[model samples]
Target chain A: MKRILLTLAVAGVLSSCGNNDTSKQAADQTETAHNATEHEEHGDHDGHGDHVASSVSGNTSVNGPVRKSDQASAILDGYLAMKDALASDNSAKAAASGEMMVKAFASFDRASLDPKQQASYDDTVDDAREHAEHIGTNSGKIDHQREHFDVLSKDMTDLIAVVGSDRTLYQDYCPMYNNKKGANWLSTSKEIKNPYMGSKMSTCGSMKTEIVPQ
Target chain B: MRWLKIAAVATVVVLVGIQWIPTPLNRGDTRADKDFIALYAPPARTGTLLKTACYDCHSNHTDYPWYSRFQPVAMFLGNHIEEGKKDLNLSEFGDYSPRRQRSKLKAMSSQIEDGAMPLTSYRLIHWNANLSKADEKAVLGWLKSEIK
Candidate 1:
């Protein structure tokens, strides 16, 4: 009878702990939703210099120095240009942007990165350059270009994860692409202008996460 | 003792009854023209390894074990294969654009090198699905040659 009572006491404690965990998880989710709303508000307030300045300073307080590199910024700019071209369904412009990105990647200063970052960047760039070249050569084949762009977006995401970004970027995902395997792309704006679907389904995706400068 | 006997019989009856609930099978009658093996034409050993390790999920045809016909397990395996094929249907490799093909090849090589394929959960049951050290070398070497 005493042993039975002990087991009941232990069970009560374990169940209570489980309840606490679930409540904590619920609170964390609410906090995350609050932060997402704040990010949306920040997007609306973009280009307002005072707002931008205050947010940058606020972020700096949480994170360390903002990672800034002219070469990385140039590569990011070229990538964004290509994204915009694809979103606009302009194959030739996308090809030109792809060529520009290949050059940007070629001239990227690796000396600025640490050894681990350099290794990851090198692996990513090799595949990225191949994708860019495919896009650059297949100017008229928009479908083929979109396929390449789909994979190239992954490489860009990987590159940014290692090299860091100069400005805030949004990672958007389209669930209907590639036979429902889904695909993701980075954008400078919060708006969903899906490059994968172009005008057919321009607003098909939603922002999954925001990458702020750190 | 009577209650224990009744409970045991009830469990057995429930188990047998559940087996009648059918699950969708991934087996296909014919090989696709764009099949990965047909397109790439890897060596015999590499081909066999891929079939054993990947085709069970990533291709249209799965070599179902006899036990896989049972309940709950069948549903679980069906869901797994569906998710896997969505990510990569190797049977339709030839249908992908050249750039997408290149990207997929690169991903395959990296996944193999990282020991992330033939997923750990899968290897636990399908003993032959585990890629040995030499298997990894052969697969990666073949993938590298094809990535270009």
Candidate 2:
């Protein structure tokens, strides 16, 4: 009887230890989530000299990447299809294609870009539509439409580069960086270029708000 | 038993009554546009989109939601808006000077492409602010031109 009781006590102690471990895990996960959420909520606007600016809030639990995963992706696909269709300079097809891209660009998720960068994105979307519509309706050359394509392509390229490189600016600070990969950081190997001047070392982090007023 | 019933009623009353209490509105400070203009000047379409969708939180002047007048929720909104604008303020764009503006635009484009801006939680309620494909192209296109 004594041996049996001792075995039961040991088992009970082991089970309690397991429970404790489980609770610790749960707490850690919750704390990490809480901290991340807090960072996003507060970090969106940390040090501007003006009035209090609110961070653009988002639910990080959504399905897919912070960029390519939403409804905006489908719109991009359709726009690309139209671009391809219009390549033949088929007026009718081009018009239809142009419309698709226009609608797609107009409706692209504005909420995706941060406030500081949102204005430029908006302008690009509008300009691309204007060019596409003009090229589609008129007897413009395919080269002309391709010019607009170049414009759109360039914007997309820049946007991609910024998105890829900007992980460090907000990863430790903004909640928007709460994607599955955690905050994206810069690898030391890459030469940080300045946004204003290509090939300059003025990376995005260089523009951080100044601590002292000029 | 009577005291117990009274206590239950009081608790319910407090819970129900708290919802009725009005919270302060966030009538953000908009006088800081000088800095905003200096730091960033988006091309036409992209600038418009930012003004419409992001200026509320990221700038000095937040539009404020209806429920923002309620406590707790209002507090949450206040903290968020303050934080957002601090990280990047549209109203204070001019403050950054030319070099800073260029860099800011680069950051702006990247954040948009990466789907880190308008914030999903924000879009859930403000449906009009949602960017369709065309909108994305316009904004991104403009940024590309300016950057190039």
Candidate 3:
């Protein structure tokens, strides 16, 4: 009877130890899961914080020193809206948006340009603006205008690629001032030049400029 | 299954036969009158990188892939090359005046920075053309230095 009692006591202790080990393992697993969740939450928080920091106010001017994100945003919005209008087959709206777009780009000061670039810049803008207006206003071939817009979009896309690489232009032209940096209209003298143009065209030697309001 | 087999055979036959079709390798009649050579004479390392990655299509001398001899694919490649070269030919880079060169350079940098050029689709097939963060920094660094 004594031995049986001893054996029963030992079995009870063993079963209790086994249950404790399982409980400890379960606790460790829960801790591990909690840690993983915490890490994920922390990562998400960091991402959100970055997004918040990079966010821009629409009306802000990107006039000198640091390029304002909002200026890029505004131009991008205008261009995209113009594209959207064209895509939707809204000729009047496209023309209007296109005019605004051209005007936005045209506001750059001519003095900033190297003489040849300046002259060419003016010519190209005039031609592009004229063609855009004609296409926008005249009902001759809306399809042709749309095609032209598509080509322009392509040219713009290609042009942007080159501009993105040319940070020098961004540094010199993207800002509102030069040496005499002070308050001025938010604009980018950042220009686009067509490298493929031969000498026959006057603007072929020039770059197109884009100017924006503060 | 029989129809599918016949269609597959027909497609293969047509594809093989197209290799014999002569395609015009038209090159632009680039003029020597412009300062084309002078401008591109001293290409920076960044310019070299751009040439390697983008100029295949954007320049006159497109390093055609061996497989470009095949039809449909060859035609598509030809069209891209022609259009790209038409848009911007680095071979004729020196022809533009300083202002034009500067603008073109700016446009080149802008396109790269914006993640637009060397289209992702093109890069998918040509893995070597893919730009890494380091490559981008190097290329943009050189381009940004040009404004002065």
What's the TM-score of every candidate structure?
A: 0.46, 0.37, 0.44
Task: Give the range of the ten consecutive residues with the poorest summed lDDT in model 2 chain A.
Answer: A1-10
Q: To one decimal, what is the Cα RMSD in angstroms of model 1 from the true structure?
A: 22.3
- Scored against the true structure, residue A34 in model 1 reaches a CA lDDT of 46
Clashes of each: 0, 68, 25
Instruction: Chain B TM-score per candidate, please.
Output: 0.86, 0.74, 0.79
Best by DockQ: 1
Which numbered prediction scores highest in TM-score against the true structure?
Answer: 1
Candidate with the greatest lDDT versus the true structure? 1
Q: For model 2, what TM-score does chain A reach?
A: 0.37
Q: Please, what are the lDDT tens digits per residue for candidate 1 over residues A1-214?
A: 0000011111221222124477744543444334434544544221111122234334311223224445578788888988998888999999998899889888888888989878777877877887887789879877778777877887786677667778877766555565544566879897778888888778765555456655
How far off is model 3, as Cα RMSD? 23.8
Per-residue CA lDDT of model 2 for B53-129, tens digit only, reads 78878886777777766656776777778778755777776665343454456556666776867888788878867
lDDT of 1 at A118: 85
lDDT score at residue B27, model 1, on the 0-100 scale = 68
